[model samples]
Target: MKGFFSLPGERLFHVATLSALGFLLLFFVGIISSLATYTDWRQFFSILFSKEILFAIRLTLFTSTMATIISMVFAVPAAYAISKTNFRGKNIVDTILDLPIVISPIALGAALFVFFNTSLGRALEGNLMRFVFEVPGIVLAQFTIISALAVRLLKATFDSINPRYERVGRTLGYTKIKVFFKVTLPLARNGLIAASILTWARAVGEFGATVTVAGAMKMKTETLPIAIFLNLAQAEVERAIAVVFVLVAIAVIALVILRRFTSRRQTS
Candidate 1:
């Protein structure tokens, strides 16, 4: 023990470990205190059972799921193109695809608001494109933010794969589309699922863009994050904490599932 402690790197290792443990302790203490105060165990248990919260949660889940699916549909092809094919202005397209990650969500929402409040919005008002200030707007906002991330992740995953696999498939007379679906996609399935899960989790918790585009209408556009914000603004501390706890729980479950799937994929 003395020899181990006397090592040159031991001091740094001890400091890092202590700092990590201290942060973990602070985190658990906060969680416990929040759960203990302003919240009865019974209420916490029953919060998800409430009709209004249940409705909001259902709407949130539905919208996020739809947005994630749509985002993945677009992301896969875009990522494949960026990773596998040569095209003019590819760098510009890649930068634009990833530009959302740098912009403020509130700013993005405000831009959407401005665009929708103009003649373009009027033209889209009665059409299928009336996405700004509706439930679809919420989906669109989530899609805008999460799809960029998905594209980044998918592009990385696609690049990590060797193009030679596809070439070999082609030599066997398989069409390009079939080669992709049968080979590339399956090989990248784990990464794709990881990306989708991450995107869904982000979508579920998005507030700024959603509120800007969807207007936080109760039982309509009131996602979990918006519920937290609305409750906080309304001075409903207990309800806000409850909603936050729900979001935390959801994020944890999603992370666990992602890890499990990723591990299984690696082992198989």
Candidate 2:
């Protein structure tokens, strides 16, 4: 028994087992509590499949996907730069990239609303300040919240890669962009995918910022979280619960995928 405890592998196995068991206990408790409150499963299922619910689900997926795609487009390169090169104010840039994570998202949304309701948003719109109370506002809010998350994750991914690989690519006459695509990007694919998944999950669940900026219009700006919030506020408990469950399921799936990719990347 002493020898078994002394083995590093055995100790790690013990720790993992303990952690998994703890998580399972909490998960099942929450499940039971939720299930006990729902007396009509069939009615709940019917509500879940209602047209309004379906529309919210579709819109949530669409907006989250769009926000994630936009985040990835910029995050990868910014992360690469921050990881690979030394430049003026690089520290400041990195700090700024992480600032959103600390800010209250709802407050951020309100500030954005003010900015856009005034000149900044109009300047950006050029003729579409209508975005403040529209779909674009929701997307923009989601994008702002999720983009910071993407940049943080992608930066970590890039940092995990050794710069020696890029040096080797350069030695072979590969351009920076070529090296990035052929080597760095491939190596960081798992992190990028994980980041994108997490970003989408975060964007989908975003409510405070979204509500403040998007002005929850039924079937117009109502994403899943917003739907759940509006339903609960109006005393539609069952519908709200169903939506919450769906959101929880989505969040669980995203985190599971993120973990799998992150684990595979680490092991490889």
Candidate 3:
């Protein structure tokens, strides 16, 4: 991926851009360092090991995983369809799908909150299940926020794949479904994994909508992000810092896993 334009002062441009990148890294590192400096190691460990924090950690993992799975189920097919098929109003549909990704999660959460008050929402709550301010609402909120992101990523993956493989399978009498399962999916393994990782990471950090839809109930709806927010609200800065460290740790682990997976795939 070359730059769009070659600059007359190309060497100077490269030096300036590299300096900018270095500065960005330093800025973030300083932020993380401040988190560490805010509290003692023992206090951080104590806060992290507390029952409430443990529960929040567990809830965060479970909800994010559920959201990621649900997102992938719908996203894969939607992305595949959008990438492989040309249909009427596709552009319209595509744009509509992108709304969830572009819209503020807080607004999305608020909308979901409002939806549960409507007749349909009330009926679903009465007959099917409850969502608003519930644990399930956390999952729903996460799904609403990250599903479109998953679609965007998987669509790009599908777009990059050569359709020739599927065509070749069809020539040998494979049904479209068969070709997809056997041929296309294998090629999309890397993309599927990458999208899942990103979606799950986003879901884990989701706050505005989850807080809006689930409410900030300690021990119940308190995900890691919610715990952080709750602590910060009560001026429990040390506790909040601990949770921030946990989030940073999760992010670092995710990045390392992604990097390793991508490297191995490339090498293999």
Winning candidate number (TM-score): 3
Q: Relative to the true structure, how large is the alpha-carbon lDDT of every model?
A: 0.86, 0.87, 0.92
Better of 1 and 3 by lDDT: 3
List the pairs of residues colliding in candidate 2: none
TM-score of each candidate structure, all chains considered together: 0.89, 0.87, 0.94
State the TM-score for model 2.
Answer: 0.87
Q: Any runs in candidate 3 off by more than 4 Å, and if so which?
A: 1-8, 264-268
Candidate 2 residues lying further than 4 Å off, grouped into runs, are 1-28, 126-129
Q: For every candidate structure, what is the RMSD over all alpha carbons to the true structure, in angstroms?
A: 3.2, 4.0, 3.0
* Residue-level lDDT tens digits of model 3 in 211-250: 9999999999999999999999999999988899889999
| Clash-forming residue pairs, model 1 | none
Cα deviation at 263, candidate 3, in Å, is: 3.5
Q: Considering only N, C-alpha and C atoms within 3 Å, which residue pairs clash in candidate 3?
A: none
* Residues 1-268 of candidate 1: C-alpha lDDT, one tens digit per residue: 6577676779989899999999999998788576657776677767767776787788889999999999999999989999999999999998998789889998898888888778877677667567765788998888888899999989998998888989998999999999999889988988898889999999998888899989977777788888877778898777777877788889999999999988987786
